[model samples]
Target: MTEGDGNGFDTMSRRPPSRSIIEAVAEAEGVPAHELRPPTYESLHTVIDPDALDALFEPHADGTVRPAGRVTFPYCGYTVTVDADGSVSLE
Candidate 1:
């Protein structure tokens, strides 16, 4: 996923993960096997600022904020959403 700043700069970018890959990583990370699920795409415009979207993709950028298009750990059955303007939210 990618989002551009108002001035046309790509402020945020993320790579989608295959279902198998996500499951494997989650298992290796000690996330509950029964709790894992594929991530779903969602629009973030309703929740956050566009310029901050890029930060979500950055590893450990903020423990409190999750990146769009990413699945949460421990099988919460939720995915992050990133809007075109770079805002982020969970769906």
Candidate 2:
């Protein structure tokens, strides 16, 4: 695992998440969860918005609506789809 010390970038000596984290990500993505596949670590770091990605993890904090991993921002109606491989494909 890599750790950032409040800087642009840094490295850490921690291990990555287990298979369960993948399952949790899948569940958060609203898919079969178990069927969801893990994405490459590099891909995971490519997210443009960290907060937006976190929103995908635990969308609801205190029972309030939150943005999905995939989203159509500034639009009234639309749907977002987050693939198992951590790919965001829109329709």
Candidate 3:
């Protein structure tokens, strides 16, 4: 488990991560939430397609989402990783 410092940042730590994938990444970057685009933003076009990310992580017809392995990519000066347990890592 990653321990959040007083400011809610846990460098290279494995915290619960934010509900919104973009939130987690943005939080890690210390960037203003408003200026950043969510992971689902179409222009980004990450290794994990925005829609696929939503479909894999977001609620489905069963109202539940399950782990579907992991994927990592570089973005905005950080190495963003989406994990199987639904945690985002920035290192």
Candidate 4:
């Protein structure tokens, strides 16, 4: 689990098991998943560059994406974080 603020964010036991970070965040936030849109990690230009995010988090051959890092930023008044295993946390 990730170590984050206690106000609202909490570490997930495992990967969110969703197709997209947006969907994962929506589910965690208790809002409709459609409200968030992410074509790739790059879709969030306000937090990080699209191309750079893709390069950093894109899946590898055989459809396996396991990064050695994580990304955290704010979105729609929530603190959004993405982990190496595609897990997502919302605060």
lDDT of 4 by residue, 1-91 (tens): 3224654444444333233555655666566766565542234556656466556666777777675778877765567766776556666
Candidate 3 minimal-lDDT segment of 10 residues: 6-15
Instruction: Report the number of the highest-lDDT candidate.
Output: 4
* lDDT tens per residue, model 1, 54-90: 4444456354434344423222233433343333332
> Runs in model 2 with CA error above 4 Å?
1-41, 56-62, 67-69, 72-80, 83-91
Q: Rank the candidates by TM-score, best first.
A: 3, 4, 2, 1
Candidates sorted on lDDT, descending: 4, 3, 1, 2
Q: By TM-score, how accurate is candidate 2? A: 0.22
Q: What tens digits encode model 2's per-residue C-alpha lDDT throughout 1-91?
A: 1112322111121122222233434444456645553442222334335454444544366865444333322111112234323343222
Candidate models: Cα lDDT each: 0.35, 0.34, 0.52, 0.57
Per-candidate RMSD, Å: 15.0, 16.0, 7.0, 6.2
**lDDT for 60 (candidate 2):** 60
Show where candidate 1 strays beyond 4 Å.
1-43, 59-91
Stretches of candidate 4 off by over 4 Å are 1-19, 36-43, 49-51, 61-64
